[model samples]
Target chain A: MTRVVLVPGALALLPEYASQVDPVAELRAAALAAVRWLGPEAAVLGDTQGERVAAALMGAAGVRRGGTAAYLVVGNGSAKRSEKAPGHLDERSFGFDAALGDALVAGDLSGVDWSLADELWASVDGLRRASPLVSGSAAVDYADDPYGVQYWVMRWGS
Target chain B: MTLRLGRHEFDDDRTLMMAIVNRTPDSFYDKGATWAEDKAFDRVAQVVDEGAEMVDIGGIKAAPGEEIDEVEEKRRVVDFVARIRAAYPSLVISVDTWRASVGDAVCEAGADVLNDAWGGADPALVDVAAKHDVALICTHTGGAVPRTRPYRVEYDDVVRSAIDDTVAYAERALAAGVARESLVIDPAHDFGKNTFHSLEITRRLGEMVATGWPVLVSLSNKDFVGESLDLPVGERLTGTLAATAVCALAGARIYRVHEVVETRQVVDMVNTIVGRRLPARAIRGLQ
Candidate 1:
């Protein structure tokens, strides 16, 4: 079976950046559960900051990095969804995120408009690389933008 | 070392606020304000609400005043200790007295600590603390008599003298069967020392803390703060909190204070700044 899990590259998930009262507790819980489900050892696919978040989540779940059929990808949707978002309000953010979320759930990245994603501040490089191998419906664990930045925890297995 | 205050125990890193509740009609601060039993009880309630971990109930004023004998001292504090004990079961109750008889009575009435603010005037006070298995606050007053003002009391080396005297008193308490964890040493501020001496003690409080006995500092609007900033009792809170920050940095375990909320904030802030404590909920830019 080929398993793939996607989590947000949230800096808040890193132990060094942790606060006494966690701001992304629900997101962190969902991410950890999805990552742990990927198995004891797996390959991580992400950009520089995404790799750091992947390593931290791996460490927290006590999962080692090694060659495996399972894959963990760190990515998130637009950061300009609302006025309080990291990139501030953008009229195209909601539509861009809705398209991204649909693509992730359908296991297809052919419809992801790269230019619009860049304008919306979306992290989808690793998602695009792993899209060909993705198939079947995703078991969505989390999808929210509590801090104005869209995030989702979804898993695809074949 | 963990601190054991009678029925209550605290971890090593914990700092405690011991609020002063005066029952006398002529105490220096808040004179006669809590003289009535109900007013004193209200004061206790207020401090508790303000997050005081302990309350030091005093029957007699520290200064020389109309003579209050052992019988009168017990009359004022014993029943009050019992009442506070029944009211706040988890609050640590400390009695400020140098008399062995009063120590015994308050301990019997559920007092957890005997704050001998007069530097152990009654030698048998330690025995009473040991007999009741309560904590003892051993203080150094430069050998001054109880209730008497300091007159030309000069020390060859004030900090050294404070460490030696307080350590010796702490050892005596240990020898008298008081649990080592229940023994605390204090440099009695403004009790027998002049302003300069008190300031020096506050500056070099770490030496006393290094003695390996949990050090308690009673620096709440005392004469030393008044003299340092040329401010009177009502206006010395800032100076007092400044000195409190110095002591908190030096690792003082307990603070005997007048204003519970203010002193607690100062101590906690200082500890957090020095990396000894964490911010309550630090989420600033990390989120």
Candidate 2:
């Protein structure tokens, strides 16, 4: 049997069943649907909301955060860069302050010590010079983009 | 303030954190977020507390500029770095800009390295780096990208071209005076490439190791990761870590990620596999 290189295309939100249901709730369902495609031995590491999708996966396989079957979370700040254009949030779009990002990321993790200023500030300090406000003007303007939220969660737990 | 400056040194081979500090108000996410020096310092302290190994500071932004006078740019850059250095004396700092004067100013103010987006745009910047013996990272920027291409410009071959261009730029920087050991290469993922181009380059970044210098893959939730999956900026964590892991497997020496703790974990895991390898095999009957 040929070894498959599984590269799940970017996670897609499910089509809205109706106007009443929350889109995020529907997205959670779609994410759960996508988890079925992963191989047993394969582990996942990427960004998403907190651990809802991963939690759902855990329910399916009967696992926990640090159990035999495990996944990780790396909550993101924004989803996409521009409004009209489409793309994943780049490092440059993580958040406003370290504290804000930490608060957001804290929602996704457990057992890790999270303070007010998680790591957003350091991330900001490192790249701000190369990617100054003047340069990132376009992205800033696109803040209203639905996918521009700067949170990412990677599922590693089973 | 206690600031230290060095490369991304890992602690117990876990993860190394290099926090980002933007002095410019025009930065993408928190545009005008750090317009005030106190606010910038507060952010810096937050990253340090959260666990960052080094801090990178920049006066100018990453996008193309309309040929501003080199002297004015240098003066503006050095002034801010000087202030930062004085205020936070113990922080390990890196200055981001391709101007020679800016490099000199930061070094004079005690910065440890010079991160050049244009990879020595003025060549004098190379001299500044040599004079201070500062570590360097070079990223390739397009002179201009055709508007017709919109975000998706053409690359002869994304991976090969990126590596070649980076190596060429590194060679030039080295020839001008920057030391090889102090040199690092960034493929300039978002400088001009469109979504597809960025993804192609990032996914196949291992090819960059052949360039013979440490590669720093700074793909912290970049645009390509979002577009590929139709994710909004807020929903890119899965994509970001996935991208980081891909580059790490490609032999990236340093990963400039925004999500520190998470990226740190992935880097630790990937580096374990990349750092260790069964020794090279004897050539075909040559040995």
Which has the greatest TM-score? 1
User: Residue-wise lDDT of candidate 1 within B149-251, one digit each (tens)?
Assistant: 9999999999899889988998999999999999999998887899999999999999998989999999999999998898887998999999999999999
List where candidate 1 sits over 4 angstroms from the true fold.
A81-91, A116-133
DockQ of each: 0.44, 0.01
**Candidate 1 residue-wise lDDT, A58-153, digit = tens:** 999988888768899988988888787788899888888898899889887777787877788888877877787678789999999987788999
- Give candidate 1's iRMS in Å, 1 decimal: 2.7
List fnat, each candidate: 0.32, 0.00
Cα deviation at B234, candidate 2, in Å, is 3.6
Of the candidates shown, which would achieve the greatest DockQ relative to the real structure? 1
Alpha carbon lDDT at A70, candidate 2? 25
